[model samples]
Target: MFLRRAVYYWQLIAALLLPLWLFVGWGIWGGGAWTFVGVVVAAPVLFIAILVVTLIIYGRSEVRAANAVSWLDVALLALWHLSIIGLGCFGATGSLFAMLTVVTGLAAFWGTLWQLVRGFTRRARQTLREFEQLAGQTPPRGHVSSPEQGDVYVVYESRDQRRA
Candidate 1:
């Protein structure tokens, strides 16, 4: 249980930190002074932007939901972060390995983005369904009317609402 919770929290932490780590590590390893300086300057700005977007989208409760991060997220994080570190170690040289690393990193990025979009769409649909259900229960204020003596209404309903 403890391990699971740790991994769950780590996923969120990694999402926040991995990009900065990769950029700074690569810049330093590649021995480009300007690259290092640029990444250092950009890291906090990028982190802040991502943090704001995340908070706006997920909110605090959603962000803290138990088991919110799955194994797939951890796997993708590992794949992308490791690929980035590999790219750094390879000195940005144009080689097959470097290309493969770039592809892996990109795949991980797209996969994570796809998951986020799908989750958001699913949540939106659920909320819409709930809103529709609520709306169905209440009549319009100006159009409200009580049942009249001659009004026809169903006397009994089955759980499935199918007549036998």
Candidate 2:
């Protein structure tokens, strides 16, 4: 439980810090000068994707209520983040690993979105069921759903009175 909450928070901060790490890591151990060009493209996109995944997951009411990410979210995030870190290092071919990261990031997006849609649909179904139950309920012996059952008095005053 604590780990899930921590992961949720980390996902938020990762949006900024991970991309920065990619830039700094590459600058230090970059294969060549051309790597910076890739960083220029990948870093911003990575940043955006991180935020998007975080937001999509957070959009789930269950996550917000629990203040934690699901196991699936943690798994997808671990893959995506580790891949991003892999992108920073030059041990493997930069382009190859970068492509891997891109694919994983895309997967994360799709995964989070899928969960969001499913949660929303489930909640909507529950709400419709509740509405049906409510509609089936009969009112008590005396009920006043009509407005005329109650009387109201309006108090109107000139706006100029307050100005004085």
For candidate 1, give the lDDT of residue 158. 40
TM-score of model 1 relative to the true fold? 0.50
Model 2 residue pairs with clashes: none
| lDDT per residue (tens digit) for residues 1-164 in model 2 | 98899998999799999999887897788556677777788788888888888899989999999999999898889988888887788775767777888888888999999999999999999999999898888455345456765644445555687668
- After superposing all C-alphas onto the true structure, candidate 1 shows an RMSD in angstroms of 11.2
Candidate 1 local lDDT, 1-164, one digit each (tens): 45445655565575567556757566566656665665576456545544443333244234357645445555654565465455445364524544665566556556656666777788899999999999998655445355663444434544865654
TM-score per candidate? 0.50, 0.81
Q: Can you tell me which runs of candidate 1 are displaced by over 4 Å?
A: 1-64, 91-94, 140-164
lDDT of each: 0.56, 0.85
| lDDT, residue 26, model 1 | 63
- Top candidate on lDDT is 2
| Candidate 2 ranges beyond 4 A from true positions | 139-164
Residue 84, model 2: Cα distance from true site in angstroms: 0.5
